[model samples]
Target: MKHRKLISLAIVPILVATFIATTATLSLAGSSINPRLYGSDRYETSTAIANQFSNQTVSNVVLASGNDFPDALSASVLAHELSAPILLVDRNTQTSKAALDYIQAHLRPQGTVYITGGTSVIGSNFESLLSNQGHQIKRLGGSDLYDTNELIVNELNSTSDTVYIASGQNFPDALAISSFASQTNSPILLTQTNGLPKGAQEYLTNNEPKNIYIAGGTAVVSGSVENEIKSISPNSKITRFAGQTRFDTASLAYSQLAANPKTIYIASGLNYPDALSGTILAALNGDPILLIDPSTPLVPDSIAMYLAQLYKNGATPNVTALGGSVVVPDEVINNVVNLLNGQSQSPLFNITTVDSRLNFGGLPVNLLPNKTIGSTLTLTNTTIPIAVFIRR
Candidate 1:
């Protein structure tokens, strides 16, 4: 008791807890991640935002470094990429000499469908394709207007039901972007996949977007991009498409777009568009496009559900024994078929939407909840050929 004044006190636990709490709070507030840097200063500005809010580092960025951010008119163009008007041709139909013959046959007076767009060389080549096709589509933009506010009052009036085709990088100078939010007073910079122009920036000053795809490719984000348009828009409609290396397969990408569609989003090759698995799946939207090739199990949710529902009585294929990079269980393969046809097998039993939990100890732990079968798609043809477009 004489040494009470000199007691060592056990406040260590409290201090440790305080420190951890502080650290966690700060991390939750915001932590930056380095993405593969690409494009001009405006693009760099967008990269800086990614660094501030993300938690990953990019060792290698793919797209070339160039200043592609839009000016006023260009910003108007970016705003235009809200909802895409995609016209998909079936692979079977596409391969038919008749299909190519049809497209070549339908090449309008100057008919060329621009498939992609960003803030770089996509402009000239884009114009050429459309022009060569006999169409005269001109970008109505100036410079530095990623938000489409400028285009709202001025542009939309001119484009009525006009399919503004853009591919391989676009976002015309943001006089104002107008592809979406036709009724928003000043055209609330509505980009489900990317950021809006300046006005959208002002509108989204304190809000998040419906969806924001932060890729380091041609569709790179612009300067202070998030702050510029996140608030002006809505998060429920926003979709951020980051953590991608490139757009490889037609099948994978189609799934993504179906999950979240957009007019202005990042893609792998703008010049050479890939075949979309969705195109085929669309054919069977109301029917079943079964992938019964025991060699390759059907994974697309739409297709899987169709298969599951088609075989409520268990007539689905036996693809659990296929040899590939995957090792699927038998019941799962069968269940997938049942679920696909709109039949109700425990909704929780959807192996197609669950994680392949593998634990080192006892049984694997599933860390996520179940998912709902949203939509259906069909693949009329399994095999598709790559079609290359030559801009004359």
Candidate 2:
């Protein structure tokens, strides 16, 4: 009995090793990439993102209205500065339970919660709720959305010579530069397409940032606005990042921010909530966030083209999709995987294992025959520990 047990113990490791080797070989056939989905809803997604940093103690939390984008557009930089998570709350609700719970659990004892936008946008009741919990609350709202953005920038007390200007009328331009802005500790100021907002004008006139980067094309941010910015900060070096579409604009922004990233994040371009919270997480890793049209089944052309060049240069970035399938569907993610594999369609197909009795490390494993295994196999929780072989 002792001899038999020793032989079984030896065999188990060999089987495990063999299984891992086989699967590793199959995984290497294509880019070892997969999309990790964050949450089921926007509110839940923010908590999920916050949980990513659970290992560390968060000192502050930024609360913004999920109903609008303008107030939260400039919150990323502030969140990065505070080493906090940007949590989205419903303006109608007195409090967001998920956000509150996360704050209670992670925030330091004396930590303060920052609220963007006025009481009209987030309400006095929400502030009262946090104050009741013995948490210090600081409101950074102004007379208007632009003012709120400027207030957030002022709160940063950033002396960095670089600043970013995006269209306040839309979310794409602002969201595109969010991660980069947060990473660099640069304030992202919002402006109108034809004219600069008073808040932004005052900031430019006073600070005169040496480097100004304008996101979006001339149509989104008119030449007049650019010239106005130049005139306000004449000594500042100005650069504009624009593309044919919002998706293209995101690609261009990311390409300029990171040369060869090992990880890339995707969020729906149609909405701002996912990207808003996601920017903090991406910024923490110095990664870029690419916007995708969730309505489309395939990846955006510009994103695909940009990723293709990265793959050509031997980059296999791990792609993560923020939000649920409703916002960023499985089809779009599959297309990205296929693109990385240099295939127009999925190279995966169901393959029946020839040996069902195979076991590795006392766990059941499905062993594929050498002749039938494909180039890649996507495994889920229910179907892992699979070993594939190529028929010689």
Candidate 3:
């Protein structure tokens, strides 16, 4: 009976499963894929993002003006809520064929394609173009950016005791924090550098949040602007995370908001599109993003210090580099990897030899059920004895 027990046993199944897994693990660190997302241009990059994050079937898609960034910055919340992807379209050019192709191929949208801006930015004929392709259109816009932002906030149908305020004049700071705000259900209201715009003020008056967060320095959004906000909501606790530069501001903002996330997305500081599309994915994954200088090939010293600190505090150094090598250079990638691997430990523990697997896979044959023969096995921090049943 003992010899007969060996006949039905086969370690080959276990060996084959482990071998395949070990091969795949060779290119990975820990369980995270550490994906580098990029494309030839912004339009394609947005599509690539959808491909990675959205399932093959989706009902809605958010379309924003590719000619500018303000509209898209406020659109992330809607996208996140609808489980949709945001695709940018050139204002005069209408919807880019790549975006339409992505929708046709991946999304299979039987519902609405929400447009962020009105006719002036995306053209009046745009809605018809999408309708021709069989998508119902819902337009969200107003006379200007602030009005549009207010409308977006109203669309959310939800608010928090906290609100994030950023300048509508520029895109960097707002783009940097959009993901965080969306994830937390905090609407990002835009204001001019000198004063709070009427629509934005109305938004504050309507919501009456308890905590107001300013996302940029005085230069981008002045003290006068901050005071205007405080006047509207005098009882609210106001906090500012500003810095000498946009990069520093982003770092400070991330430090304040992200409580030790598993992944960090690195996007270009100089441009907006990559970060714009990347934010939705970042929010979905519960990751925070840091902006980098696109012109330089080396990692900035401040960013390196920040990453090193995160590692020291037991945060996994899994990073996703957005944009192409032209935008995020190869040297920066090497520096990031080196910094994460600096603790004299490999990010991935690979089972390189059969001897290692034999020692680890020493389990009783009875534990593995029938037909699980070629299944992968994972043992973590456990002392249970695993046998390798070999049939000779």
Candidate 4:
């Protein structure tokens, strides 16, 4: 339940949406969806957030992006918004400049910068960026010097009093960490358990622990997990961060974080297709309840809320890109073809693709929408039209 007085929406998320299969002829050409034109009301940095939004306590903030770097401003703003420690996921030299730039822009000279991640892969100077930003930075383990497994184990082992959990995207490494934590018998516990699990679903009811851990705000702690929170942990703290990658990976991360009285789940991969959504991030109020970039906000609008509402209402978004292969599936192709099967000809269906992705430079096929075959028309050899990234 969010603020009903301030934010109003037909609020929905398209994560589990079942895209309708349409034939080219049946698609009903010229149909369009109402696109929302909105952005942030104000610009902000990562000053103090996540906490205000979380129903729990979180220790660190994790930055997970599939590409080069999360928008420096966005990450920096988020760190400031959460006011928790920060973790940069793209730990590599390729990311050095972006990381450094992030620090220079966000960190104050007196701040302490902590160097973590594979050292050899990401330069030692990475930590310096934070240190120079006025924050005190302490260098943690490095990947360049050791294996992430070893580093993760060593770090958790060294800090026996604290427990660390991995959340977000279904990364193999993140999943392994969850299994390892459950197997370990140390007092320093890294938690791993989903509220949505068949077993835990029953346990969480009135099982009333002081807190609950969420893997990522967007992934695991959603769907049935939402129901669990509604039934059990409504008052339970939601310690979530941006870290995990896929839906399952995030579930594991939230699993680990839930171990504590106050859990902190992290989102892993920010770049995965459909990994996020615009409508999902907008309801970005913290447990503390603050919306800095209310309009052009970063994270998807209340991913959890949207998921819950969409599921409840039986509505979803028009997202076809996440399943992979932007080439337009043969099913869709057939739909278009079949639609035109009965008719002699069908109007050309327009395709809008970004420029960089189109490779028409060396296309050998003809660049036409549908072809003319006898009395019936057909569409084939799309090497040209698929070259959306290429210019004519």
TM-score of each: 0.27, 0.78, 0.77, 0.33
The residue ranges of model 1 lying beyond 4 angstroms of the native Cα positions read 1-103, 110-133, 139-199, 202-337, 342-392
Query: What lDDT is obtained when candidate 4 is compared to the true structure?
Result: 0.29
lDDT of 3 at 271: 84
Please give, for residues 295-385, the per-residue lDDT of candidate 4 as tens digits: 1112222333322333344332222111121322222232222222222222222222221132233433232333221223232443222
The pairs that clash in candidate 2 are 370-391
Give the per-residue lDDT digits (tens) of candidate 1, residues 85-191.
12212223222232223234333453334322233323344444335655545343333333223443244333322111111133321101121222121232323
Q: Which stretches of candidate 4 lie over 4 Å from their true place?
A: 1-82, 85-95, 128-135, 142-350, 354-392
User: What TM-score should be assigned to candidate 3?
Assistant: 0.77
List the RMSD of every prediction in angstroms: 23.5, 11.8, 15.3, 16.6
User: Which consecutive 10 residues in model 3 have the weakest lDDT in total?
Assistant: 17-26
Q: After superposition, how far is residue 332 of candidate 3 from its true place, in Å?
A: 1.4
lDDT of 1 at 178: 23
Better of 1 and 3 by TM-score: 3
Clash count of each predicted structure: 86, 1, 5, 93
Poorest lDDT segment (10 consecutive residues) of candidate 4: 286-295
